[model samples]
Target: MTDTPSKYLLNVDYGVGGVTTHFRSRPLGDDLHSETMVLNLGPAHPATHGTVRIVVELSGETILDADVEVGYLHRGFEKMCETVDYNQVMPYADRLNYVSPIINNVGWCLTVESLLGIE
Candidate 1:
């Protein structure tokens, strides 16, 4: 329905298509239709400490489509901060990013300090 074929075909904003609408493979042959396979990368063990699900569709060696779903790392950060005292939130923010957690902790502390009119 959109200007791009893949957007309407794959439902992923001009990416790739699937089964009945595999535009690329259709041009390869008419007698044999290429079967698409879906591969799940992860909902855990991500490079960044958070959990993420990566879905990839493949037609042989070529990638037909893909989708990425992001998770919250089960921290419930906002709610947790709300229930705790202002000083208690520093530790939680420090754990947000493993590679450079101190940055997050400092940023969170500064934000809370600003809100309380503390220089």
Candidate 2:
């Protein structure tokens, strides 16, 4: 039996002839030793279905925390809109949701109409 310097003390058995050993940690800090891990899913991975990034924190195979990022597909969408006239911006809006572009087009129209106080 030996003690290792860690958050939890490890009990290890060194086999005879120094061939092999087995070890396990018994946490000294808390009654339940919950080790956490952080995972980055991606802005380019297929499962996400789009240019999005996810940050996940895990503890013992359970999710402890998560965060999401969107819009890696078109970073210039907003910037390009700013450089164009309102009517010209429709094309950019349509591209924002290419899968169902009519939704983006209608949403942009509603936003513009509301901003201009048009019925």
TM-score of each: 0.58, 0.56
Backbone clashes in candidate 2 total 0
Clashing pairs in 2: none
What's the true lDDT of residue 12 in model 2?
A: 48
Model 2 C-alpha RMSD to native: 14.8
- After superposition on all C-alphas, the RMSD of every candidate to the true structure, in Å, is 11.0, 14.8
Model 2 lDDT, residue 85, Cα: 95
Segments in model 2 whose C-alpha atoms lie over 4 Å from true places: 1-36, 72-74
CA-lDDT, candidates in order = 0.73, 0.74
Tens digits of lDDT, candidate 2, 1-119: 54653443342443246553222335666745567766788878878666788888778799988877776565588789888899998878877764788998999999989999999
Top candidate when judged by TM-score against the true structure:
1
